[model samples]
Target: MADIEIFTGPNCGYCREAKRLLDAGGYAYREHDVSQPDAQALMRARLPRARSIPQIFVDGVHLGGSDDLAARLAQGPL
Candidate 1:
């Protein structure tokens, strides 16, 4: 399976939904809450122009936000 990492923030609905889908699929992932000050630089590095929360990465590839992740999931497994 591919490595999955999720960049999230506080009070993010899409982040919760992403987690739900991953959990349902039994996919393990690392979650980073960008709401924290320490994670700001890292989040910026991952998504330069990202203006929203729930940015997800699969094997180092930026898969975009929750809707994008759902679209990818619908297309089938990675």
Candidate 2:
């Protein structure tokens, strides 16, 4: 299985969509709520220039946001 991590904020639709796609693909992931200070700091450390929520990482590689995830999913397995 791949190591998947998602950084999300509260009530984010894109975050929901991203999780849904992962779920549908039977991909297990660790979710970090960026609303929390520690998680926010972690996310920033991983992606310094990210200006949005639902930033995803696969096996420590940045995969960008929800739309990018969708595009990646469309290509094949994560």
Candidate 3:
């Protein structure tokens, strides 16, 4: 399995959906809640122009948000 990271904020619907997809796909991931101060700083460092929630990374590669992840999943397995 690949190392996965999900950067998200509280009350984000996309974040929840992303998590659900990962769970259903049987992929483990590290979730960083950007709503927290430390995680927020980390997310900003990673994505300077991230004006949205649920920024996802797969094996250190940026896979974008929930929609992006879903699209990737739709194409094939990661």
- Which is the leading candidate under lDDT? 2
- Model 3: residues with Cα > 4 Å off, grouped in runs: none
- Candidate 1 residue pairs in clash (backbone atoms < 3 Å): none
lDDT of 1 by residue, 13-66 (tens): 999999998998889999998978767779998678988989899999999988
- Lowest-scoring 10 consecutive residues by lDDT in candidate 2? 43-52
Off by over 4 Å in 2: none
Better of 1 and 3 by lDDT: 3
lDDT of 2 by residue, 27-66 (tens): 9999999999999999888888888989999999999999
Per-candidate TM-scores read 0.93, 0.95, 0.96
Q: Residue 63 deviation, candidate 1, in Å?
A: 0.3
After the best TM-score superposition of candidate 3, give how far the Cα of residue 26 lies from its true spot, in angstroms: 0.4
Residue 9 in model 1: lDDT: 88
Candidate 3 TM-score versus the reference: 0.96
